[model samples]
Target: MSTLQSQSKIEEANKELVRSFTRTVFVDHRPDRAVEFFDPKGKWHGGNFGTVEGAQNIAGLLTAVVGGLPDIRATEQDIIVKDDTVVVRLVVEGTHKGNLLGFPATNRRVRWDAIDMYKIKNGKIMDDWASEDGVKILADIGAYTPPWMKSGN
Candidate 1:
């Protein structure tokens, strides 16, 4: 195969790897399976949540999310892959069944968008940077009152 063909093949494989990982961990609600996709020292850069190091810590974060939204489902809106990187735009929907971000259970359904970029190495995720629509999520769950919704305005 030519160099260009080999590069394209690698990119496709990386994209598939990310898709599989997302299916196993988020869509399947199996945070315990994170170790299968993440590198031993994988790092997750979660905006506002700080940087989480190690696959176990990343899994812990996922566990918390699943705990709060037991029925959470992530639907991929877009996916872009190049070489060792994969970026996914996702629409996440769930019910607030348990505490999340220090907010008590609201039992409200919420939908939000998120974009995550992952760096793959040796078929494992070595780093991930995630950005989510926190304000919308909080508003949907009644955790945040918008300025326009405030009384005496």
Candidate 2:
């Protein structure tokens, strides 16, 4: 096969890996699959949680998220694959079923959105950056009050 063909195959495999990572981590909540998706020294970033590295840490985090949102589901909006990068847009929904961020379950339904970009190397996800609408989620669940709104109270 030509070099172009080989590159195409690699890109396709990377895209599939990103998709499986999303489904496993956010949809199916498979801890083992989370480990399979990320490289041993993989790095991931989310707001406030700081940087998490290594497959075992990522797997533990995914497992904790599954516990926090037992019915959470990610509705994929778009996917773009180019070179070693794959970006996915998703709308997430779930019920407040367990403790999260030091708050007890409010039993409310919450909808949030996030975009995740993964950097693939040798078919393993090497790095990821995820941006999620955390403030909206916190406000929706009554866990947070906007600064401006707090001044009015």
Candidate 3:
């Protein structure tokens, strides 16, 4: 195979892998199940809480989120792949059934937008930057209290 053909093959493989990861890990109830798809030094950056490295740490985070949104589903709205980079936009839908961020379960169904960018290396995802609208989620679950509604404010 030629060099261009090899690169094209790699990109195709990466695209397929990302789609599988989305459905099996992000969409399904078990994000950690895609452990093999991540590099040993893989890092998932959540912006505020810092980077989460290692499969175990990522799994813990996923598990915690699932604790609150027991029926979470990450429905991929768009996926773009190029070379070693993959970008995905997801509509995360879930139901509040357990405490989250110190708020009691409200049994509310929520749909939130999430975008994730991944750096693929050696056929594994070595880095990820993820962003989600959190304040909106809290409000959807009736967890956010306005300053005017607070006792001291």
Candidate 4:
């Protein structure tokens, strides 16, 4: 297969993985069932609290985090496929129904824009780097006070 074709296949697989996680895993809170979406030795980076390596660790984190969300949606804004990699721009919308990161449930709808870059090898996702608008989510829930908001913009 040509390089472009290979890239496209990887991108498609990555998209399916994302869809599976959003619909089946996140919505159902089935973290233990997410082995299909990640490599056994995969790593997740840039999650603010810490980096998680290995499927077990990631699964544990997901279980804890998803326990509180009554509803969650991950919407892809764009996807770019390159050789052995797929980059996705996404918006994560969720409602907090339980405590998270030391904050109690406000039942607030949180919307965070995120960018996720996935590395694929042998048609499976090997690793990922993600960055999300954590500040915006916190500010929206009044948990954060931006320094620049002194003038109340």
Identify the candidate with maximal lDDT.
Answer: 1
Candidate 4 C-alpha lDDT tens digits along 1-153: 997787677678767666666566656667777666778898888778578888787777777667656576677788876666778888877888877666889888888898988887765567888887878878766699789764757
Candidate 1 structure quality by residue, lDDT tens digits, 49-97:
7899999988988888888999999999999998899999999999999
Q: Which regions of candidate 1 are displaced past 4 Å?
A: 148-153
**Who wins the TM-score comparison?**
1
TM-score of each: 0.93, 0.90, 0.86, 0.82
Count of clashes, each model: 0, 0, 0, 0
Poorest lDDT segment (10 consecutive residues) of candidate 1: 24-33
Clashing pairs in 4: none
lDDT of each: 0.91, 0.85, 0.82, 0.75
Judged by lDDT against the true structure, how good is candidate 2? 0.85
Across 1-153, the per-residue lDDT of candidate 2 in tens digits comes to: 999998899889998998888887778867667878899999889866678899999887777766777788998999998999999999998888887656678888889989999999988999989898888778867999789668657
- Runs of candidate 3 with Cα error greater than 4 angstroms are 145-153
Q: After superposition, how far is residue 83 of candidate 1 from its true place, in Å?
A: 1.0
Model 4 regions lying over 4 Å from their true place: 1-11, 27-29, 150-153
Candidate 3, 1-153: lDDT as tens digits: 999999889988988877887777656677667577788778889886578998667767777778888888887888888889989898988899988766789999978899999899988888889898877687789878656656877
